[model samples]
Target: NLASQLTISKSQPIISGIDDIKNGKVPGNRIGLLVGSASLEYYLTAVSGGNPNYYPLYSRDQIYQNLLGNKIDVGFIDTGNAEYMTNDVYCNLTIAGSGFN
Candidate 1:
């Protein structure tokens, strides 16, 4: 319930890389978050770090593809899924630093 916890309480801030949310640099000044991603729903959104400005993606694969293609600035994938996506041969995506654990 960290997302809920953080969503309710906005004291602690969720820090992200500048590149992920810079004006006009990132699409819509928003990052893609998985609606079903527990970490993103709780952690990333808790402090309004990466709140949804657009629509949420159902599958991690979609997030991965959007991120790699620069359609979305960033996304929240499980650490495991991040690893898997990073290993994809077709991807040229780079992780935004220090957003998640």
Candidate 2:
């Protein structure tokens, strides 16, 4: 029952769609995922066709911080967390895509 959403920093090149990620247009090493979330990890791997470049983050706040700092180019977060991050003043993130359980 894990739903996830893709987000990127406002400064990143606009990702037109999910195809960019699947085709390896997006740098693999720059993708971030929650450290302990098995579902997020699995989804990233499955979507990327088994390419493993997803960085494991400590928490949702860390994901936001790393993304804003350009430490990571993209991140997968809980859908609800994505909504909050997008609306929060401190987090300048854009919704790139969404996936459901």
Candidate 3:
């Protein structure tokens, strides 16, 4: 239930860590996660402290696309997906802070 992790833009200033989300530095509505996904629910309850203001995405590709397009400020994708994005896919994006598990 805790295998999935998160990554965000290295350049994003508002959110450097999960604590930022919990502390309200990053607006809950600006966070992106897959719609109807268990990870979304887990993150909402475990990381966001039950704040339900995340933007629901349909797929990981959409999450990356939206992040690159600036439609979404930040997103939570699997750690491996984050690696692929930063290494083989979107070069502009990188792991935000130390990442969250």
Candidate 4:
């Protein structure tokens, strides 16, 4: 799980590619991009088109908690952490696509 991708709750539909992201067909639009993370580009370019209205999480725990709590619908994270978090620590989440480096 060395790649990176969008992570969403199992309750949401899986997004198979970047087209889904750009088309507003993601796991719900309430995105949580951690401040200062590389994921910001995705949120702004793919999700918001530079609107900056997406939810801004401050930490890894905060992002996971928000997703689990339904405060946010999705997050962008490294696939390694995404795998461990979803498969081992939290079973209700999943990577949205095949992931990229």
RMSD, one per candidate, in order: 9.0, 2.1, 2.0, 2.8
TM-score of 2: 0.81
lDDT of 2 by residue, 1-101 (tens): 67777788877755755667677777777888787686455655566666556787888888888888888887877778788868875456888865644
Clashing pairs in 4: none
Best by lDDT: 4
CA lDDT of every candidate: 0.48, 0.74, 0.74, 0.75
Query: Candidate 4 has what TM-score?
Result: 0.80
lDDT of 2 at 50: 60
lDDT (10s digit) by residue, model 4, range 6-101:
787888665665567668765344777788777776567656778777788889888889988988877878777888988899888877877764
What tens-digit string does per-residue lDDT give for candidate 3 at 1-101? 44454556656755666667667776767788998776787777787777678888999899888887777787887777778878887887876655555
* Clash tally, candidates in order: 1, 0, 0, 0
Off by over 4 Å in 3: 99-101
Give the Å error, residue 72, model 2: 0.6
Q: Estimate each model's TM-score.
A: 0.56, 0.81, 0.82, 0.80
Residue-wise lDDT of candidate 1 within 1-101, one digit each (tens)? 22111010012123245333433344433457667667555534443556455437778667766655556655655655555555564335544444343
Top candidate on TM-score is 3
